[model samples]
Target: MIEIFTDGASSGNPGPGGYGVILKAGKYYKELAEGFRKTTNNRMELLAVIKGLEALKKPGNEVTIYSDSKYVVDAVEKKWVFGWLNKGFAGKKNSDLWLRFLQVYKLHQVKFVWVKGHAGHPENERCDQLAVKAGQDRQRHQIDTVFEQEANKL
Candidate 1:
């Protein structure tokens, strides 16, 4: 089985944001992280999971994801994403990310486990640290084009 721990952070609700991911399979491990110049915490949260899944080298693996975001955990655990997909993601925020998630999601048997953030969970805390550092590193942050475009539309 593969275990993944993920976290996201933002300086402001819709400000600079980033995600951190830790993937482990037996003794093999990998970390993924990136920052977005303008994005939401929820977007970063969901993106962390997506990035983790995308990093998997094999298909049809048994995977479990640990996250602190109820927004992301509940959406997948409660099966809301399927409904959203059925309706073509109408009235949804982050449709781009959600769609990207679905594409990578189908390649594995995935489960989500929710944990309390900042509760001293070692891996989760490390992920949170990575996320915050990435978010605050302005020089390395990349544009969140979809978010920027949506803001421009308003």
Candidate 2:
């Protein structure tokens, strides 16, 4: 089984956000992180899971994801995303990422485990560090075009 640990951070809500992901299977391990010029903590949180799932090269793998975000864990585990999808994601945030997540998500046998953040869990703490550092690195930050455009429409 593959295990993924993820975390996200933002300097401010909808400001300088980033996500971190750690993927492990047996002895193989990988880390991924990226910063966005502007975004929300929830966006970063969901995106971290998306990124980790997208990293898998093969389909139908047994995967378990560990995240601190109830926003993500509950949505999936409680089957809320399915309801949102059926309703065309109206009045929902992060529909774009949610759609993208569903695409990759269907290819795997996936499960989620909620972990407490900043409680001294090793992998979770590392992910937090990666996310924070990435968010702070202004030079390498990428534009979150969808989020920016949506915000502008408000």
Q: Quantify all predictions' global Cα lDDT against the true fold.
A: 0.95, 0.97
TM-score of 2: 0.99
Model 1, 37-148: lDDT tens per residue?
9999999999999999999888999999999999999999999999999999999999999999999999999999999999999999999988998999999999999889
lDDT string for model 2 (24-87, tens) is: 9999999999999999999999999999999999999999999999999999999999999999
Top-lDDT structure, candidate number: 2
| Model 1 weakest lDDT span, ten residues long | 24-33
Candidate 1 has a TM-score of 0.98
As for model 2, its CA RMSD to the true structure in angstroms is 0.5
The residue pairs found clashing in candidate 1 are none
The runs of at least 3 residues in candidate 2 whose Cα sits more than 4 Å from the true structure, single-residue gaps closed, are none
Task: Please provide TM-scores, in order, for all candidate models, with all chains considered together.
Answer: 0.98, 0.99
